[model samples]
Target: MKPSVSRSESSARCPRCGNAFDCAMHGQPFDCWCREMPPLPADRLDSSGRCLCPECLAAEIARVAQGRPRGA
Candidate 1:
C-alpha cells in the first residue's frame, strides 16, 4: 500500500535513503526547497515517483552535472 501524507504535513520520508526529513514539497511543491535546486532527470526518479530529500537530490544533480553515470 502507498503511504499517506497529510495535506498540512511539512516533512516526508526520503525514498532513496528511508530517512525522515523536512520536505517543503509535502504540501506545497511550488514553494519547496527543491524548487531552488536543479531538477532531477526523469531517469533519476524512484519507481514510485516521490521526491528525494535535499541530500539525495543534490547528490544526483552533482552526479549528473559531473558526467557520472547513475548510481556511480
Candidate 2:
C-alpha cells in the first residue's frame, strides 16, 4: 500500500492537487463533508489512498459519470 500524505489534525493538503483544506475525518465528531459524497469507484481511486479537496472530488465524480478518467 502507498503511504498517505502527511496531515495535521483537522487540516490536510489534498493529495491530488496539493490544496490545503480543512479536514475533520479524524476529529472528535468523525463527521465530515466527504461523507455526503458518493463513494468513488475503485478503478478511479488511482490507488493513492488519500482524500481530495471539494473541487477535485466534485470534478472526479463528474468525470466518472461522463466516462472519463482522471487526466484524460
- Whole-model Cα lDDT per candidate? 0.75, 0.78
Clashing pairs in 1: none
Q: How many angstroms is residue 43 displaced in model 2 relative to the true structure, after the best TM-score fit?
A: 1.7
Compute the lDDT for candidate 1: 0.75
Model 1, 1-72: lDDT tens digits are 244454335778877776666776546435788889987778877788687877888999999999899878
Worst 10 residues of 1 by lDDT: 1-10
Residue-level lDDT tens digits of model 2 in 7-62: 66777777777877777877888888988998788887757667788878988999
**Candidate 2 structure lDDT:** 0.78
Candidate 1: where is the Cα deviation over 4 Å?
A: 1-8, 26-29
For model 2 the local lDDT of residue 72 reads 64
Q: Which ten residues in a row have the lowest lDDT in candidate 2?
A: 1-10
